[model samples]
Target: MTTETAGGPTGPAARPAPHRVVIVGGGVTGLVAARQILRDRPETTVTVLEASERLGGQVLAIDVDGVAVDVGAEAIHLGAPAAADLARALGLDATVIAARRGQSVLLTRRGLRPLPAGVGPTGPTRVGPVLRSGILSWHAIVRAGLEPLTRRRQAADVAVGDFVQGRFGREVTDTFVDPLLGNLHSGDIHRLSLQATAKQLVPVAESGTSLLLRALRKPTPPPRRPDEPAPLPMFASWPGGLGALVDALASSLEGHATVRTAVRVEAIGRTGDTWRVDTGEGPVEADAVVVAVGPRPAAVLLGPHSPATARALEAVDTASVATVVLAYEREAAEQNPVLRDANGLLLNSSQSGVLKAMTNMSRKWPLGHPSWHIVRVSVGRAGSRVAVDLSDAQMIAAASGELATLIGLNATPVFATVVRWPDAMPQLTVGHPGRMAAARAELAGIPGLHLAGSAADGLGLTSTIASGVQVARTLVG
Candidate 1:
């Protein structure tokens, strides 16, 4: 029953062996955790087991028209420091570049209309833009203008949809909030937790101040000093796409940790004070274990060890989304200035179609193929079943038809690729905080066990990385 320590062995004549840690899942969260642990405790043995043959879970890249394009996540919100800090630590700071263009329009029944200028991603900040954009009716505009003067009552938590609807009216919620937040989180705004999604605006809501007044009072930034460098872009990504980040993380773990692909972890249990992980290949014994898989898989693995934690995790729901990338002739896009000018387009929920959003990839980032134009179409949302049930061909057709209707481009694409992510995004409902707190409490009672990922925390890239680093630091300490 005796195990050798890190030094060498447990026998009187041998040195103690190092602590053993096993991480299930090779996605960004698990990879980051392995890297952090190895960096902090070099002598500790770390093993990362991924079911898939590749490392990154949702972050991936593919070739279209002889150019590498991001098929999964493509941007990181610079509002948070976690992603940027990790990039700097990994020596990827120089590779980071902001979006070449920031303008996005909404595809409505009337046609494409610019989203109100100066409007926050989730809602409108200024009334002038909303009025001038012509996206709202005159009545809706008047109601929205009165939002600042409206009285505000604060609650501990509220749904993003309900909060915006009550304060700003239904027009703003449906036209602005739904499409923007839906495209970002891949979930329904009515179910998305306000605190988890838009923590910045909560204070304004609670203060009962006029949103317009507050936004107008927002002071302009002081001029930068001559010696100061330019501020980082609001969003940034790697030149090779987000997949490069995954490759970088894996490369950094070389010589320090063991990484195994195509290894599925069936179950995890504790034996004495040590932990045992059952994989398809064999069983792994470790001093500690980190479960970085999705909530459903994590629930199954923890069910036998901790039913309460399992129940909490199983209660969490997820959404599925599919990305369809189409590469068209550059002439087709050039012929239509709208396609060339738009960085991205968000679909109004009221619009009749399967396509939820479209990103003009070529315009957003240089793909090194000037002769080709790449457009990425996102399908499905929190409550929609269109993407999960449809075949890849059908999805592509739907996307193509929608694109043609939105922009006048009917020529066949030179290349097309579909990436389906089933149950990849976690739905953070209003009561999510309580469930997460309970899960954490249950995990604290179990020794040598940790959980981290988009399911455990919020769905942003920053939150996911921060969760991994936080858990690894706790285990290392």
Candidate 2:
């Protein structure tokens, strides 16, 4: 909402206002940092420069045929302190509801089958349902039972795929975890750090107990505040969609924030005490600069300033991902078995020929409602042999075909939307934390320079928000 020259709020022709702090990247991280900086230090001038004209990076939402289609992140996994704090700060009206975890279908060679209870993303949390389910062979179940007897390999961290395949057998990893947790990371399980990705179940794997017993006896710490309610499915987007959160944060800055679109940051270099940021238009000098882009971009920008940081960032590989949004008539799709669907079913990459997973947006969130009868299908992995290669229309056709087989549907969708994110989700390899620590230490010497993004921490809205808030605290402190 504010416009100013490189001279900033104060120039020789005008009275000086405050210290100028430039925030690069206008995604959630940059916007959050701008808000935090303005709130913490009113004397400081905050500006957000985004390469894209639109903000909210991955938390993007669009209206298609009078229906709200979330092209990016649909769910908010923020629990407790983060969610409550953010909701209050933004004055966002959020509805508390649990994610549709039950009434899911598991696609198999036979047909769409009811998802067996106790078979979580990690493994069977309870043994009864798993034993009864015909999904796994008897031999595979016996192999799973031997997990407690298996020795915990002494390593800093291992790939989730390796660990699961070694302990539970390849069938479990491919059949269940691959489609469930694997899809969560866009199906780059081999590269995904077990420490960062499947940390909740790490202790169970480490303990000399079967996953079922471990899950049952897992010592979950009681809430510090008993009166506070458990977060409802982490948190969902407000009525207007996730974009509402971004718009609210941007508006809160008022005239303080300056968002530059269609301007690519060519390079970032250190100039004595201050850092110089090079853009397509020109260079902007600032006392502080936050590189909040993806890891690959961060590596490119920080190469001159901090080679170690750059290399460290480069160590974290990124995977390309695609999200396909398809719409169908509700009554027409009712005949499909999977379509009796409570929400949507998550498909394992190995089982489903085309899709990694799918979400029934209309059933899950209020934005789409039932009229749209929307479904979101994910495709691709961080790195894998087999891959899905199809244009928007082709991808939709493939997904529709799968739907037809799974649910017995023959009707065509009105229209479909596809969002491709190239090198978006970062693959946090083993020893990721250590590598990040070393990079941070190297960059610590440089004053007025900070790092914040999905690449900095674990990929998620909650983590990205925390990175921005933490960087702001570091600066103010």
Best by lDDT: 1
Give the alpha carbon lDDT tens digit for every residue of 95-168 in model 2. 44445555567665445666677666665677677677787887888887777676474353778778887777
lDDT of 1 by residue, 326-386 (tens): 8889887767665678788887666748788998888888777968889899988777888
Off by over 4 Å in 2: 1-19, 93-103, 108-111, 116-120, 124-134, 151-153, 201-211, 219-230, 368-371, 384-389
| TM-score, every prediction | 0.91, 0.86
Model 1 alpha-carbon drift over 4 Å, by segment: 1-18, 126-128, 205-210, 222-230
Clash totals in order: 10, 2
lDDT of each: 0.80, 0.72
Q: Candidate 2, which ten residues in sequence have the lowest lDDT sum?
A: 6-15
